[model samples]
Target: MNHLIRIIAISFVLMPPVFAQKLVDPAAVAPEYRDAAEHRRTEQLRQRACSLKAQQAKILLRDRAAFVLKCMDAADASK
Candidate 1:
């Protein structure tokens, strides 16, 4: 009876491992789902880049305007 109990206990411990091995691999995910995920990632990167570019452009424009205004003020003061 002790041997039978040990066998049952060992099987109980090993059974979950056998079940875990049946899981689907991530690489084997559906092609359409994978492609959609990739597309979303690309779109997110593109949007981030575009937003940063726009912010940089705004800063450049503001600096140019400030420099031009400073030059005009100097000219007015000289007159």
Candidate 2:
């Protein structure tokens, strides 16, 4: 139908947003790391740990956010 074609065309024109990875602060980043030469080191370590855990567990893509959040929480608690 013409209407269906028009709707599809509109949908194609209004494309879904692309996702980008942004830098995030570590939940438990130490004060020492804040002013260090490598300020992002703590967050980077947390991110690396989270990534390793996710990969080791073969976590689903949709569940990565929750898993990373919980992992950060645990890391924070350890401090």
Best by TM-score: 2
> Which digits, one per residue and each the tens of the lDDT, describe model 1 over residues 1-79?
9999999999898885433223234356687687666666655554545545556666575465555455445555787
**Model 1 accuracy (lDDT, Cα):** 0.59
RMSD each, Å: 21.3, 6.9
Candidate 1: pairs in clash? none
Off by over 4 Å in 2: 1-37
Which whole-number lDDT from 0 to 100 does residue 13 have in model 1? 86
Residue lDDT tens for model 2, 1-79: 9999999999999999987565545445566654652556667778778978998999998998899989989988999
Report lDDT per candidate: 0.59, 0.80
Decoy 2 TM-score against native:
0.52
What residue runs in model 1 are displaced by over 4 Å at the alpha carbon? 1-32, 59-79
Supply the global lDDT for candidate 2. 0.80
